[model samples]
Target: MIKIAVVGCGQIAQRWLRVLTAHPKVSVTALVDTDLAAARRLHALGQVDAVTATTVHQALALANVEAIVNLTPPAAEPEMTRLGLTLGLHVLAEKPLTVRAAPAQALIAHAEQVGRRLMVMRNRAFDPGYSAFVRSVAGRGPLLAAGETFVQLRAPGFRTAHTALADLGVHAIEQARRLTDAPVIAVRCTEHPAAHLAPHAGLVTLLLEFADETVVSWRGGYAGPGLRTPANGRWSADTATGSATFDGQRQLRVGDEMVELEPAAPGYELCIGDMLAVLTGGSITPASVSATDHATSISVLEAATLSLSTGDRIQLAGTR
Candidate 1:
């Protein structure tokens, strides 16, 4: 069994723990959180018989962990992942990878130097519905894409107008990249005030132009007072051949035909399963969200944030 340490005991951590504890080839050896009681609570709820620690050092001292599942907040992810890689452990982290591209690239380089795997959870990529949509649009030279998300959220103090893009919209950005199979070369973003949310929180819209000349328009916010969208949001793309749409309800419409989608486990379960496979010597596919691939997503988000602030279309380097 691959002995793993789960760092961070937040809601995302709970979801990951459910997958980790239930997996036959995995064993959760330790839980780490600043709030020791939170770690203890998850340890008990998961019934994994793991030790709890308030720090990564204490967790490492207490357990023989070979890998780290980092569910820490975005700010803490880089340090946690860097420490894990430095300690000769593989790391699977939650998204945004870091809040910016430079540090994410640094972490990728460090993981390579250590010869350890570093992956970020792009769980949407593993969703059966989204997977089906990607397959349907394969080889169909996409031209225009659009994504929409609306949900009522209780604004946290840390969620600001700029941070909300990475916090919530990164998924859509990643999805657009996947659909177009191209690098985002430039981005323009705009934020509008939402009366229902905190002053810092607003509805965000972005226009991303990819290297292949494909463009994606994305809009999302936490101000859906009466109407709420699915967590995955709604995605559509226009291609040379036809148009394809995913309703975020496991339903995909491709031109005149409705693509059939098989029901699958939750994204967390599928992502963990793939991670286990990789740890067991299986090859990582291009679709897998490696740290290197996710760095580009971080770059797009960072550029979008800059655009939101400067009111200028931000251009990215290395998009060729």
Candidate 2:
């Protein structure tokens, strides 16, 4: 059995631990968090035997861990990942791999050189609901019109300039890139003044043009009261035959058929499962890494920042 250690005892960590404990093929070896008490409490609930409520350095040294599932905030992500990679431990880090793109690239490069698996938690790709949406729309070929919105009406911890786009829009931007073969050639965003988060609450719209004459427009933001679907996030793909709406709960609607899928798998479990599968002589797939780079996501966010500052469209440098 693959031994996995979960670092960070936040809510996301709890979700991961819960799922990891339930998986029969994997063993939860250690629970590492800054707060030893919190980590122990969570482990008790999950029935995990080993627990380390200390710094990653201490936990890494103590646990006989094969992989570390990082669930820390954006600020601590880079450092933790760097240490884990240096130790030759396979790392499955939370997304927006780093706040900036350059550092993220360097980390990925190091991971590649060391022959260690460095997977980012871009779980939305594996989301059963989202996957259904991808399959429903991909058949249309070269998409014409597509829009994705990821807005956080309520704060779910960590509120920073990077969080709006990197944490949330990473999924949307990636989904857009996956749904449409075209890359985001240009982008524009707007932000409020410092009094109102300056450029915090803004909108980012991307214009993508493809070789097949296909065009895709994607808009994402965390401002205003967004989306009528209460806690409802859906990716609707429009085709000539009709449109399919993949509800957040793993239900799909294409044409006249509305199929209810089994409660889709949880994101963290899927991530850990994929990682373990690879260690046991299975090959890693591109699906995980295709959108793992948060640099493009950060760059697009940077453009949005500029647009908000100048009140004009900020064109990307390479989109031409």
Candidate 3:
């Protein structure tokens, strides 16, 4: 069994704990959080038998851990991942990898130097419905894609209008990248203020152009009330032959046919299972997003952020 330390004891961390504890190959050896009480509270739930610590260094001293499940916020991801790799532990981290592409690339290089796996969780890719949608569109030529995600969200204290694209739009951006067979060549974005929500929250619209001529338009926000969409949002793609659409739920429409998708295990469970398999010597598949892909996605987001500020289409230097 792989002994693992779970870093960050927030809501997402709790969800991951439930999945990790149930996995036969995993042993939850420690829980780490800045707030030791929060880590203790998670331990008190009785689902996991583990020690609690305020930092990864403390957790290492307290337990014999082989890997780290990094659940920290985006800003903390780079440091935590680097520390884990430096300490000779594999790291499975949450998304955005980092707000900038350079730092993410640097971390990937560090992980290589240490000969440890450094993976970012792309849970959405493992979702059965989204997976089906991707399979249905495979081999289709350069396409036109569009997606919209509108949900009423209570803005967290750490969120702001400027950060909305990185937080909510990354999924949609990555999804678009998955659907297309080309590199994202340019990105343009616009942000709008939402008066009804918290002062820091608002709406974002993004336009991505791919090297193969595929173009994707995506809009997402935390301010829409009745306009709320499912967590994955509504998505559609069109090629010369036909069009396909995903309601972001159990139904996928491909041309004249309807494919019913059955609900599967939570994405976190599936994602962790894949990671375990790879760690146990199984080969990696295209379905698993590589560190290179993660860096490319971060580059796209970084371009989008620049677009938001400059009001011009930002061109990527090259695809990572």
Candidate 4:
């Protein structure tokens, strides 16, 4: 079995633990977190018997671990990812890769240099909602137009005046890119503040023009004001063909057609499985990285954030 180590025992880390524990091909043999208590909690959740560490180096020294699952915040992501890659261990990191596109690209470069796999955890693609989306466009050819909305309810850390597009828009943008395989050539964004902790309750009316002549419109908010019906949930994708809609959330639509799915695997589980497969000398495929897509998707979100703040259209530079 492939042995794994989890770094950063946050909410996403817990999700990774749950999914990793369920996969028969992998075993989470170690845990690491800045907070020992949090790491203990994750250890308990996974029912793991391995010792927990307070740092990446400590975890790596354990000699039983083959990969690291990084669930840390964006601020700490690059450094942690660097550690894993330098140690020749595969990494499955939380989304947005880093706070911006530049550093994220650097991380990818380092991984390539070291021949270590770096997979971003973009589990939304594996979501049932996204599954429905893929089926809608599988054989239809290049898409003409697409749109997405990311809505979530009020919770602590829900709203901020100056928001990081990497946190919210990355999901929508990446999912769109994966679905369309088209690069976002241009971007424009706007945000609105509210009474919440952040000035803006939510954002509205964003646009991304793809190279394939596909225009993507996106809107998202957390308890955003002026909008009827507060949509408190994770990001979701949708697509349509002559009013026959395929929603990432609802799965089957209009008479239960079988939407082709790569599989129903969870993100962390898929990440771990792919890492182990690589250890056995296998190649990585889209299905393996279905939960992960780095580079260009992150650039779109970063560019959008820059646009939202400066009131200028930001073009993604050096996109892969």
Candidate 2 lDDT over 255-310, as tens digits, reads 77998877756654676667656765557544654324445655555555555567
| Candidates by lDDT, descending order | 3, 1, 2, 4
lDDT of 1 at 46: 87
The better candidate by TM-score, 1 or 4, is 1
Please write out the lDDT profile of model 1 over residues 1-320, one tens digit for every residue.
Answer: 88999999976778888888777888889999999998988988888888999988898899889999988877777898999999999998888788788899999999989999888888775577777877888777757888888777675544555555877778877777777667778999987877545655568898989878788898987775654678778888888889889988778999998866777786757777788778866567335657777788888888888898899999987452
lDDT of 3 by residue, 262-309 (tens): 878756578777877777665673355467687888889889988998
Global local distance difference test of model 3: 0.83
Q: Output the lDDT of residue 141, model 2.
A: 61
Worst 10 residues of 2 by lDDT: 190-199
Query: Which stretches of model 2 miss by more than 4 angstroms?
Result: 139-141, 146-156, 191-213, 218-232, 239-243, 250-263, 289-320
lDDT for position 187 in model 3: 90
Off by over 4 Å in 4: 126-128, 138-161, 197-201, 224-241, 251-281, 287-293, 316-320
lDDT of 1 at 293: 78
C-alpha lDDT (0 to 100) for residue 278 of candidate 1: 86
Looking at model 3, residue 20 earns an lDDT score of 80
Which candidate's lDDT is highest?
A: 3
TM accuracy, model 1: 0.92
